[model samples]
Target: MDKNLIALIKILVKKSYITRTDLEVETNCSKRQITYRLEKINDLVEAKKLPPIEYGNQKEIIIKTETKNFLIEILRKSYNDKFYYFDKRERIIYLYIMLFMNLEYLSLQHFMSSLKVSRSTILNDLKDLKQELAKENIKISNSRSKGYYISGPELDIRGYMMKLVLLSLEDDHNSVVFDSIIDDYHLESFQFSKKTITELANKYKIHFVGDRLDEFIYIFIFLKARLKNHKNLTEEYLGKPNLDIISEMKEYKFTGELLSYYKDTTGFSEQEFHYITAWILAVSVGNFAEETEDKPIISEIVDRIMIRFEVLSGTHYNEGPEIFKQLYSHIRPAYYRLLFRLPIYNPLYPKIKEEYSELFLLVKETMKPLEGLFDGEIPEEEIAYLTMHFASIYSKKRDYEEVVKKNALVVCSNGIGLSAILYNELKEMFTDLNFYLPIDAVKFKDFDKPVDIIFTTEYQLHLIEQNIPIIKINPIINPRERYEIIRQVYTLLDLSVFKQPSLESIMEIIWKYATISNPTQLYSELLSFFSSSFKLKNEKKEKGYRLIDLISEDCMNLGIDAKDWEEAIRISGNSLVRKNKVTQDYVEKVVENLSPYFVITPLVALPHTRPEFGALSYSIGITVLNRPVEFGNNEKPVKYIFFLSSLDNKKHLPAMSDLLHLLNQKSFFEMLDGTKDKKAVLEYIRCYTSQSTISSSTME
Candidate 1:
């Protein structure tokens, strides 16, 4: 039999259904080859009088539960006492598991025999394994008498082992390999079950999701195994100062109660208790009991952070008590993690950093004061979680406001069955639009809701006379149809689409006035000009607004002489004060709060304080230095400075967001560097801000 067929039989015995894609990955076979092999396996199964395997409705391979055990037994017998061949990566994993799980010294002959490989091959694998372990600060120690074993700080070893276990759980193929390791080592079954953990959680009123509960159980099992092996995670392994927050958590009591189950069985230590408490702190995912004594401090700190966040981002979070409660819940666990120096992994960190760059920075800055409470800095991973919380609230608020502003009516033939489905689909797709109850085609004329557009399954010729744009869509919309409908909706509502200037209109004046040596180069430049100019032309300008209105020539300084970042900040802030936009005290406050963390990105610094800090009006001041000045960290030196002052926290948000967006653009910085004239810089700012607003609004 093919090795791929054997692998498939193993996976099928373990799971009722496995995806064809997963089978393809495991067997390294094409889809057609998998089908052919499944047929051959079924032929063999029938010969043994077992049920035939087939694909279920979801296109996953299915085998009856009664037949799975027989199939597994037959496959094991067919192995004929041959050891499975492991690839290089698999060899490393096998070695790590052996060293990590084995309490007794492992002999070189043991690995060679178990792997069915020669001694030199095993030695080469061990050499590669040692290099891999060194990256994690783990070492493989050898003694002539005791053979080889892994030696590391117990916490690091546990962390690495946990990662390996998690990897196994995520990949079915890896789980199969991991099971073999468990069998080889004769590892004990998990001491604590899910029911016991759930019961303990309920008794203490600690809420954990199903996945978190699984994680806690795994952690408990690992801790028990380590204790049974007489390997303890010491206080020095944790290396964190004693925090009052850990003691205050109700999870501390829950941890003590849960571990009492293993106390007489495996024995426990103070370090073991703290280790379990830290795991609980890290894994618990829901709100804690509301009656805790530290609620006041949590609430106070949340309030202060939100206020500072509002001032820094110029956006208000006014969801009231619910927002406060949610933030408080997240902050509590986060506080424990920071206090104990435990790391929380956020898989979405990269995407969050890329998409919500401004909000991420704002959350990081707002967290500075809270960090002082623990006398340590919060990692970016923790801040990303906070960013998600705030960003979620902000998105909901924006969608709510937009829904109130725009309404749409759906018309269908039956107006009940398919209409309801279509209405729900459209509502989910266009969250900013409020969708009303569907109306039958016959009653469409009588329905009135002052809607912005009419979406119908069938074309309505009469609705054309009513001056309302009618969009025709299929009752069951596919992806392409849905996209077409959305594009039509936006086009009809004049949100995303705008008229572009004609090429002739743009080139007429330039061609009439200037002589061109190369028409190709001239046309390229003209096309670029028309693109930028027309984008600005189509932008909806706010009343009483212009770039010069925010930052005047008097407040703009070029080649400013400054000794350091502090002086640089003061010079720009003094410009704002001189223009009567802010007070001198605001400059001092801004300078005092300057930190390397506040560097928005490379080569730019935005220094500002709360709106209440002596601001006369909402304004910005710009300063460009001839040379870079070292900020808090020399790694990110500053040459461009923006001093912001706002009369109201929320009013300056648009400008601040626009400024940040502009800074992200390479061309904007190129223009700033190439020119020292204030007017040219102001024009670039004006055009970029206007274009950004239009683009942002259109996206909504």
Candidate 2:
């Protein structure tokens, strides 16, 4: 008995006996070959004292499914060996003929058309097919008068094609070649699902070799079509946070309001969003979880989704229709969240249409028309304030609470020295606190003031009231204890926004380090100027006014140094002076993209740069405004200038905080508008800087 005969019998049993036509379609074996193989199979079974495979009245072959599966399993193992000898193309052609056996009325023209070949080619291929079949004891009964037919015992071929498809996926070269051929023509001319199988193979990165490429391509295409229509889908909660992949953000108790808010802000549909936004929020803290290190988990999840999709479609993995649908459903939403949270903006919003509405609206506001100029989206990414606005907003939400901060006033017996120390320390401990200190010592009756709390030592009790929230401590307080007192005051006042700085004295240390040039001259002159010129403006005494307006005139004078400074002091931004300083590390990247300092707008240029570049001088250059100039984008202008020149980024850190304190004053910008003389500008800065309510952008 021939090997082909044995193979046919095995396929029949393996598939529980498929139709003869279906067998040929799957195996590409000719009817003549199938018949010959069946004859040999019968002889072999009789010789072995085994029952022969049967054929039903319907003319379908019969084989035990279990036995066929076992044969296929063995054949698969053999296919792996390079030395395994079989003519794969010849096998397919042979099976094709067998599956359509005994159709004598189907002439040579019909056969040629069905096979998608020329008459001569078909004749020649048929000759080879017949010869192969003869070897297996099968015969094609044909005459010039009768055309052609086949006679044989049953032969099953479903298992043969199933095995072929599996083999094709295992060896990728075959699938690639098959895909190329199948894509060129519609195979209804050949009657097969070309795309379905090919798509599945591609998704799995499966490759094929030899002649099976066309079949694989057909399978893949079919799978793709089905995927597009959402014909098959299933879902499961895989769990929160696929730590294996950085792209997979951890799952949160996602609220619809949050989703709706996000949609309103970004314009992406809820179904299109992912948890990556949340992931970014987590990563910004600069620490990562141990589980996040695993990469294989991502690949595994992708695989599971792929396989599950196939199961739902009731098709072989590669041959299932709807492969693309599955792919989109499984990965795109997660990708959206990841990119939204990542450094790159590509892939998340590949186009303007994809951008969120809030982001777009914010950009529009930042680019609002100047007093005399029209506003529009600038093509330059750097010029845009979209990133800055969101960063600031995000920072506030993460670091500050919305609750109103508590106000505290510190009175001391040592006058300016103790008051300054307490004020600085408390501000460092509670950024949200509104702290104040009197310029001179006063009796307790004179110090009868309105304040949420009061902090003073035993010696200063003569100047402070016991009825107030008095936090009594040593005159020379521990820095840590002082911070705790501020914190306690904040708690008592129910201030949510009063978050302490990451480190106490951070700004102070930075200022000291940066103010290295002529510290004595700078400090002495600055202090003397403050004491003699500007008298304190009481916020409580000012009627129908914001706290900022009360101190604005004097604060502006101090900020704008006029008589001594040679050059006009302009705007100030972040900077870095020391290369080796760990504290100054944050300023490094900011300066890389932007001009270290920008002083290039009209009369109103903010003469400051990014802090990464060290400052050349350690001095404040103030220019008294003879006239106001629109300094910031046209909407915000400058009247008096306090040009900051730090030796390095670290030194200017204090001024940054100080500026924040000033800018956050509800009327700080408006107050600058009211300054009339150079003296007023200097007076305002000195008076405002001394007191705790630094109403600047930095403080906020």
Best by TM-score: 1
Model 1 residue 651 CA deviation (Å) reads 12
Model 1 TM-score, 2 decimals? 0.55
Q: Model 1: per-residue lDDT, tens digit, 493-606? A: 766443544344445556677885875466556545544443222344223223345778888888777888888888898888888989999888777766554466678777
Q: Model 1 clash tally? A: 0
Question: After superposing candidate 2, which stretches have Cα over 4 Å from the reference?
Answer: 1-605, 609-616, 624-640, 666-672, 675-677, 693-700
CA lDDT of 14 in candidate 2? 30
- Candidate 2 C-alpha lDDT tens digits along 531-630: 2222223212111112222222222333333231112231222211222221222233322322212222223332433233444443333344544544
Error of 2 at 260 (Å): 26
Looking at candidate 1, what is the lDDT of residue 139? Answer: 94
What CA RMSD would you report for each candidate?
15.2, 34.8
Model 1, runs deviating above 4 Å = 1-94, 109-128, 172-188, 235-239, 242-249, 263-267, 286-289, 293-305, 341-343, 364-380, 396-619, 622-700
